[model samples]
Each structure stands twice: as C-alpha cells, then as structure tokens.
Target: MKSPSVVMLRRNLKHIARNPTSVFNAVLMPVIVMLMFVYMIGDAFNVGVNYVDYATPGLLLLAVCYGLGSVAVSVNSDMTKGVINRFKVMDVPRSAVLTGHVVASVLTNLIAVAAIIGVAFALGFNPSASFMQWLEVIGIVVLLGFATGWLTVALGLFAKTPETAGMAAIPLIMLPFFSSAIVPADKMGPGLREFAKYQPFTPIIETLRGLLAGAPAASDVLQALAWLVGIVVVGYLWAFASFTKRA
Candidate 1:
C-alpha cells in the first residue's frame, strides 16, 4: 500500500506544479536579495572574502524564511476550502495530511534555494567548502524547512482565513533583513546590533557562511541547531494540538 503521507505529498505537489505562482512567490524575495546585494552595492560590505561567498549563506537562510510562507498559505487554503475537513472524515492517518504538506514545502524550498544559488553561481559565487560542508548546508536547510515550516503550518491552522495566514507570516520575511542576511550584524546600531547578533537567524546565517567560507562555526552551528530544536518542539505541539481540535 502507498503510504498515506506519500499520497498526500503527491497531491500537494500537483497543486504546486499547477499553480506556478506559489513557487514564484515563495522564492522571489531570496532571488531579489541575491541579485540586488551582490550586483548593486557588494563593494560596500568590505568583507575580506568574495561578496558572493559572503552573501550566499545569508541568501539561503532568507530563502528558507521566505519560502515557508507558502506552507502557511497552502495549509490555510485546504482548511478554508473544507479539504482538510474532508480528510478528517476519511480513514487516513490524520498526521499524514500535515506531513504531506511539510514534505512538499521542504521540497519546494529546496527548489527555491537551488534556483537562487544557481543565479548566484552565474554571477560568480564561488564556493570554497568541501563535500562535508556542502552536506552541512543541505542538512541545515532541511532542518530549517521542517522547523520553521511547522510553525507556518500552525499559523495557518490558527488563522481564520488564508489571507490572515499569509499576513501572519510577514514577520518571517522581515526577520532576515533585521538579522545578518545582507550585512554584518556589527554594522547596526548598538541595541539593534545586539539584537541582531543573538537572534535565531543570525546564527543560522553565520553557520552557513562559516561552513561555506571555511571559517570556524562550531558555536554558531550548535546555536542554530538549538534554535531549530526549540522551534520544532513548540511548533509541533501547537500544530498537532490545533489540528486535533479542528479535526
């Protein structure tokens, strides 16, 4: 028998393939960040390495943040349209519905990352990391996609409407800008700089940059994993609890 999760995943993927705008909206911000930051004023950073190398990690994190909004919207639409309700009545595993969406969203985010990085490569973003570093980067992205994507799913579950779900996710889009996405955290004012430095995105961005830059990232990597774990625990609780009540 086909896994119920796999069935739902294929169904969600079909929706994504049909509605190409979903993918475009999910990826647009990161692509813009990569293009504008590198080509426009990359010389302004004064980072010792190539600006592309410096900026690519930040862009990848930004892509994860931006891409997850689609997860919220997708979940919200199903709930709003009574599709989730129909599934609730069926004999399928209840968790499979959310699992499918999460799996599909992660796949979609990976595609967005590849597209954004492909553009960066065309513009001369040379990666210096070995194979292990590359694996670390992919692992982080997958973990992030699941962790943050779950919260986005919760947001959709809690929202009364799909539009509200999208609006609820706006903070995620703005998070990277306030973090270390485009510029160094030290460049900000004192209080903002401190906030930026300790915030979750900053560590993830730093870890990604370090992994790809051949710089040491042990602390940053640990912190990033800690953040993802906290988010997953909280998000998973909220999502399943809310889903149970709704179902």
Candidate 2:
C-alpha cells in the first residue's frame, strides 16, 4: 500500500495544478527582483563582481523565500475553513498534509530557480566550476528552500490568519539582505559585519559563492550545513507540536 504521505503528495499536485498563479509568483516576483537589482541598480554599488553573478544565488534563494507567501496563505485558508481539522478527523497521516505542501513549494521554487538561472545565463553569469561544483551549489539552494519552507510552515500554523502569516514571513524574507548576499560582510561597518558574520544566511551564502567561484571552502560548507540542519530540526519540532495540539 502507498504511504499516507504519498497520497497527500498526489492531492497536493492536483491542488497546485488547479491554482497555477501560486507557481507563477514563485517565478515572477523573484525574476523582477533580479532584474531590478542586477540591471537597474547593480552598477551604482560597484560591488566588484558581475552584478548578475552576485545576485543569481541570492535571487534564487529569494524565490524560495517568496514562495513561502503562498504556503502561509494556503495553510491559513485551510485552518480558517476547518479543512485542516477535517483532515485530522480522517485516517490520513498527520504529517503528510504539511509535508505535501512543503514538497510542492520546494518543487515550484526549483522551477522558479530555473528561470532565474536562465536570466542569469543570458546576462553572462557563467559558473566556471566543474559539474560536481554546480551540483553542490544546486543541492545547497534546494536544501535552503526546504529549510525556509519549514520555517514558513511554523509561521502559518501559529498565526491567527493568513494575512498575519504573510506579515510574519516578511522578516524571514528580508533576513537574507543583512547577509553577504550583495556585498562582502567585511566591507560593512564593524558592528554590521559582526552581525552578518554570525547570521544564519551568511555561511550559507558564503558556501554558495565559494562553490560558484570554484573555490571549495570546508569551513563555509560545514557552517552552512550546520545552519540548515539546525533550522530543519527545530522548525519541524515546533510545527509538529503546533499541528498535533491545535489542528
């Protein structure tokens, strides 16, 4: 027999197919940001790297961040409509519902990332790295998407309404800016550098940048993985408790 999660996955794909706008947002908004930053305002900053190259990974991550908006709204809608409660009453798996949503979100964001990469390539953003290096970078971005989706799942469960859930996600979406995404952390002031250096997004961005530039840095990779693991474990624990007790 198929696992409950597999059944839920099928349901999720159907829902996603029905509402294609959500998937469109996963691509459109991120692409707009990429164009604005890389084409419109990048040269003004003179960050010493090709603007598209620097912005590509960050914008790809932003696509994942933006995709969470839909996640929260969907969860909020389900809760408000009592759809979640009804699922709980059924013999279906508890975790499957949320996991299905997350799987859909990750896949949608991957498609968005593909569009972003296409634009990046057109803008002359080339990865001089080996095939394995490219794979490593893609793997890291996908993991980041999953970690980010998990965090949004917690927000959706805790917020009073879908609007509030989207509002709450704003901070998570903005947190990447303070990292070394657009500019080098060391180039910032001492205090800002200190904060960025320790922030979760920093190591992850650094790891990606290193891989993209074809320079493997063990410390950066380990730090990024550490942050990813920590977020997934803690976020999933909180989400599970919230779902089980309240939903």
Candidate 3:
C-alpha cells in the first residue's frame, strides 16, 4: 500500500498538471511584482542599501502571499464545484486531502521563487550568504509557505463562497507590506513602526533579511517559529471545524 502522504502528493501533482494556466499564474505574477518593485523602487528610493538586495526578501514573502491567495481560490473552487463533497463520499483520508493541497502549494511557490531569483539576478541583486545560508532561506520559504497554506485552507473552508474567500484574504495578504517587507520597521512613522515591531511578520522578515545579509540569525527566529506554530494550530482547528460542519 502507498504511504498516505505519498498518495496525496501524487494525486495533487496530477491535478496541478491538468491545469497549467493556474500553474502559470503561480509562477508569473510574483515575478512581475518582484520586477516592478526592483525597478520602480530600485532607483527611486535612497534606502542606503542595494535596492534589489533590499527587495529580495520582500519579494520572497510576496511569493508566499501569491501562493496562499491562489490556494484559497483553488480550494474554494473545489468546494464550490461539489468536488469536495465527492471526496467526502469517496472515503478519502481527510488529512490526505489537506496535505495534498499543502504539498502542491509548496511546489508551486518553489517554482515562483526560482523565477523570481532569475529576475533578481537580471536586476543586479547579489546574494552574499554561504551555502548553508541559502539552505536556511529555502527552509524559511518552505515552512512559511506551508503555514500560509494552512491559513488559506482555513479561510477557504470557512468562507461561504469563492468571492468571500478573496475578501477574507485581503488583510493577511497585505500584512507583509506593513511589516518589514519593503522597508525597515524603524524607518516608518512612530505609530506604524510600533505596530510593525510587535507583529509576527516582523520577526520572519527580519530573519530573512539577516540571512540574506549574512548576519547572525536574530533571537527573533524563535518568536517567528512560535507564531508559525500558533497559527498552524489554530488554522487547522478552524479547517477541521469547517470541514466537519460541511461534511
């Protein structure tokens, strides 16, 4: 018998392969946004750092946003089309269905990251991190994307319609921007700066920046992981509650 996770992974890959256009959006939109930020802000702002370098981490986080948004839409479409109802009747493992979608989201985001890296290079960004640092960056992206997928899945399950899913997603999607994504938290005004410093996103963005800048990992990594853990726990609970209600 196939391992449950492996079975789900294969099933997700097959489904994703059938609709390459959705896959293409997962790859292209983030790259375009990254390019826009790199060019528009690369020279326009004097942030006292190389612009592409400054923007890379933000772009990476933006990739997470793109992936999560797409996941919500896809999951909502599945639910709305009665496909989820069919799955429930077919006796598929509930965890497997969720994991399959999460795995697919990770794979799709990885593709978007690769494309963004290429664009970063063309825009003259240079990474100074060692091999291990590079691995750490990838690790952060993977975990972050997975956590965001869980959140998106929760939103998809709870929302009454696909349109509602999009509306519900706005705040979470806009979070990185108000955090350390584009500019340092300290650089913003007093009120906004205070808010940014305490939020979950700051630590994650800070960790990414430290890694990219070849600095020591901040103590904030622990905080970021704590936040990820808490969100994942609550997100899964919501997802399970919604799944049960609708099942």
Candidate 4:
C-alpha cells in the first residue's frame, strides 16, 4: 500500500496533467522570455559575455517563479472546495495533504526547469560548469523550487479563493525582474540597486550564474542556502498553522 502522501502526490500530479494552462504557464512562458531576450533585445545589453549565457541562470529562476502560481491555486482550490475537510473526515494524515502538493509542485517545476534549459541550449546558451557543477546547479534549483513550493502552499492556505491565491503569487513572479536577472544590479539607480543586491533572489541568481561560470562565490552559495532554509521554515510553519485552523 502506498503512503498517504504518495497517494496525494499521484492525485495532484493527475490534476496538473489535466491542466494544460498550468503546464504552459510553468514551462513555456520562461522559454518565451528567453527567446525574447536572446533574439530581440540581447544586443542592447552588454553583460561582458553572450547574453544567452548571462541570462539563462536568471531565466531558470524565472521558470521556478512562474510555476508557483499553479501550486498556490491548486492548494487554494482544495481548501476552498473542502477537499481538505473531506480528507480530515476520512482520517487522512494532515501532513500528507500539504506534502502531496509540495512534492508534486517540486517535481513539476523541475520538469519546467529542464524544458527551459533545453530551450536555452537551442538558443546558444553556454555554461562552463563541469559535471559536478552541473549537479550543484540542479541541486540549487531543486532547493529553490522546494522552498518556494512551501511558500506557495502557505499562500494557498491563506487565500480565501483560488483567484486570490494566484494573485498572491504575482509578487513572486515579479520578484525576479527586480533582481539581477536581466541586468546587473549595478546598472540600477541608487536605492533600487541596494534593494536588488540584498533581496533573496539576487544571491540565488548570482550563485547560479557563478556555478554556470565554474566559480560560485562562497558568500553567494551560503546566502542562497540561508534564504532557502528560512523560506522553508517560515512557509512550513505558516502552512501547517493555517491548515490546522482552516481544516
């Protein structure tokens, strides 16, 4: 017999499989952005390297951010539709309910990441990372997706409706734009530059850029890990608290 969380994972996966819009938003949107950057506007930006190489890491992060809305909406749907309540009545382990969504989300986001990477390659995005560095890149992306999955789950739980839950994730989607994703933070004006530098996503994006360049900074790696840990901790606690109260 499968564990309840595994069963829930399968259930959520089926839901995602049936939702074409979710898949498109999660996967294709980032690819489209990459195409736009690499082909259209790439010439205007001078990042001291090929724009494809410089921008792919940030686009990868964008893929992760774009995928968060579906997770939030899915969780909000369950909450608003009483699926969570039904699970409670059936004696389902409460943790399994949220775990299913989080795991399914992480798995799906990874597929989105892979698709973006493929598209990046087709557009001439190149990285100098060795085999181990590639693995590290994968690990960081997974950690980011996992951490943000819980955050979206929490958002879903807090939202009164699925639409609102989707809206709540807009900040997340927009956050990458404010970071060093498309351009270096130094290019920004005074206040915005400092904000971009200290924000959570910048370190993560920088770490990814460094990893792809084969020289990840220790500070960036550590800061990214710290942010991931903090997000997971806060999101986990808030999700369970909301679940307990709402369900």
Candidate 5:
C-alpha cells in the first residue's frame, strides 16, 4: 500500500496539473520584474558586474515567494472545504496531509524556479559557479523552499480564508525587495540600508549571489543555513499546533 503522504502528494499534484492557472500566476510576476530590471532599468544601477548576473539570484528568490502563495492558498482550501476532516475520519495521519502539501509545494516551486532561471538566461543572466557550486545553489534553494513551505502551511491553517492566507504571504513576497536582491544594501539610504543588511533574506540572497559569482563566503552560507533551520523548526511546530487546534 502506498503511504498516506504519497497518496496525498499525488492528489495535490493532480490538482495543480489541472489548474494550470496557478502555476502561470506564480511564474508571471517574477518574469516581468526580471525583464523590467534587465532591460528598462538595469543600466541605471551599477553592481560592478552585469546587472543580469547580480539580479538573477534575487529574482529567483522572488519566484520562490510568489510560488509559496499558492501553497498557502491550497492548504487554506483544504482546511476550509472540509477535506482534512474527511481524511481524519478515514484514520489518515494529519501529518501526512501537511507533509503532502509541503512536498508538493517544494516540487512545484522548483519547476517555477527553473522557469525563472530560463527567463533570466534569455535576459543575459550569467552564472559563473562550478558544477559543485551549482549543486550548492540547488541545495540552498530547496532548503529555503522546504522551510518556507511549512511556514506557509501554518499560515494557511491559521487563516480564516484563502484570500487571507495569500495576504499573509504578501510580507514574504515583499521581503526580497528590502533585501540585497535587486540592488546592494550599501546603495540604499540610511535606515533602509540597516534593515536590508540585518533582515533574513539579505544573508540568503548574499549567499546565493556569492555562489553564482563562484566565491561564496563561509559566514553568509552559515547565516543562511541557520535561518533555514530556525524557520523549519518554528514552522513545523507552529503548523502542527495550528492543525491540532483547528482540526
């Protein structure tokens, strides 16, 4: 017999496959932003390298954020529609349902990330990382996605409706803008620069930027991992607590 999580994973994947609009919505905004940055406004800013190269990693983070909104919406849908209650009555593990959503989210968002990268390449984004560095990039991206998946799941469970859950995710989507994603932190004004420097996304983006440039700093990588681990732990606990309370 297939595991409950596996079964639920298939169910979620099928739903996503049928509703192509979700995927399209997730990918569209990030692509437009990348194009705007690379074409209309890129030359205006100087990051010392090709603007495309400096911006791709940050855009990739943006794509991940957009994709997570769907995860929150999907989880909220399951909660509101009584699907989870049905699973509980059938003796399914509650964890399986959340697990399924998180895994499916990571898988779908990865495809979205790949699509964003492809668009970046078309816009002259170039990564100088070695094969090993590329693997590290993939690892970090996956880790970040998984951690945020649980966080979104918790948000979905806590929300009164899907729209509310999506709204809750808006802060996450906007967070990259405050980070060193599009422009360097030093280029920003006083207060904004300090916030951008210390925020969670800054270290993650910096690590990614360094990796793509083939010179990742140990400090940045460690900070990124610490942030990911903390998110995963907190998100997991919060999600289950919310599930127990709500379900």
Candidate 6:
C-alpha cells in the first residue's frame, strides 16, 4: 500500500500544477526584491562584503519565507471547502493532510530557490563552494522552510478564511528584512539591530552566506538548526491538536 501522505502529496502537487500562478505569486516579491537590491541599488548599501554574495543568501531565504503564502492559503481553502473534513470522514490518517502540504511546500520552494540562484548567477553572483557545501546550504534552507511551512499550516487552520491565512503568513515574508538578510544587523539602530541578531532568520541567512563563501561557521548553523527544530515541534503539536479537536 502506498503511504497516505504520499498519496495526498501527489494530489496537492497536481493541484499546484493546475494553478502555476500560485508558485509565481509566492516567488515574485522575493525575485523583485533581489533584482532591486542587487541590480538597482546594490552599490548604495555597503556592508563590507560583495553585495551579491550577501544578498543572494538572504534573497533565497526570503523566497522561501514568502513561499509560505501559498501553503497557508491552500491549507485554509481545504479546511473551508470541506476537504479536510472529507478526509476525516474517510479512513485517511489525519497527519497525512498536513504532511502532504509540508512536503509539497518544501519541494516547491526548493525549485524556486534554484530559479532564484540561477537568476543571481545571471546577474554575476557566482558561488565557488564545493558540492557538499552547496548541499549543506540546500539542506539548511529546506529545514527552515519546513519549519516555517508547518507553522503556517497551523496558522491556516486557525484562520477564519483563506484571506486571513495569507495575512497570517505576512510575518514570514517580512522576516528577511529584519534579519541579516539585506544588510548586516549591526548597521541598524540599537534596538532593531539587537532584534535582528536574535531572530530566526538571521542565523539561518548568515549560515548560508558563510557556507556559500567557503568560510563555514558552526554557531550559526547550530542556531539555525535549533530554531528550525523548535518551530517544527511546536507547530506540529499545535496543528495536530487543532486538527484533531476542531477540524
């Protein structure tokens, strides 16, 4: 027998294929931001390192952050349109529905990341890291995406409608700006700078930057992994409880 989660994942991917615009919508803003910052005014924002190197890590993560928008809206739509209820009434495992959304979101965002990187390369953002280094970067990004995607899933379940779910996902989209994504955290005002240093996106972005630059750091990687793990565990518990009790 095929896994319930795999079956549901295929169904959702088909739905995504039919509506390609959703993927574009999620990635558009991040792509625009990357272009604006890297091409339009990259020279204006001086933070010591080459702007492309700095911005690429943050921009890729930003795309993943915004990619949560689609997942949230889709999850909310299913709940509102009786699909989750239909699954409950059937013999399907409850967790499969959320797992399917999560897997699809990660894969979609990974593809979006690849596209973003290619565009970055076109704009002269070449990274000369080893194959394993590139793999590590991908791994970290996917882990962070899983964390954010699952949390958005729970938020979607909590929403009154798909609109609210999209709104709920806005924080993730805004996260990169507050972190060491676009600029170094030390460049901001004291308060905002301190906040940026400790936020979830900062270490993750910094870790990716370090990895891509071929000067790997351990602390940020640990911090990013810790944050991802924490988010996934909490989000999973909240989503499971909410789904079992209410949906």
Which residue pairs in candidate 1 have backbone atoms (N, alpha carbon, C) closer than 3 angstroms, thus clashing? none
- Candidate RMSDs in Å, in order, are 1.4, 1.8, 2.1, 0.8, 1.2, 1.4
* Maximum-TM-score candidate: 4
Model 5 off-target regions past 4 Å?
none
Candidate whose lDDT is highest? 4
Off by over 4 Å in 4: none
lDDT of 2 by residue, 128-236 (tens): 7789999998899889878888888888888888899888788888887888877778888989999889999988888887788899689999999999989888778
lDDT for model 2 comes to 0.81
Full candidate order by lDDT, most accurate first? 4, 5, 6, 1, 2, 3
Clashes of 5: 0
lDDT of each: 0.85, 0.81, 0.79, 0.93, 0.89, 0.86
Off-target runs (Cα >4 Å) in candidate 2 are none
lDDT of 6 by residue, 16-111 (tens): 777767767656666878889988889988887778887999898888887787788899999999998889888789889999998998888888
Cα lDDT, model 4, residue 104: 89
lDDT of 5 by residue, 173-238 (tens): 799999999999999999999999999999999999999999999999999999999999999999
Off by more than 4 A, model 3: 1-11, 14-21
Identify the superior model by TM-score, candidate 1 or candidate 5: 5
| Residue 53 displacement in candidate 6 (angstroms) | 1.0
**Prediction 6 global C-alpha lDDT:** 0.86
TM-scores, all models, native as reference: 0.95, 0.92, 0.90, 0.98, 0.96, 0.95
TM match of model 2 to true structure? 0.92
Candidate 6 Cα misplacement greater than 4 A, ranges: none
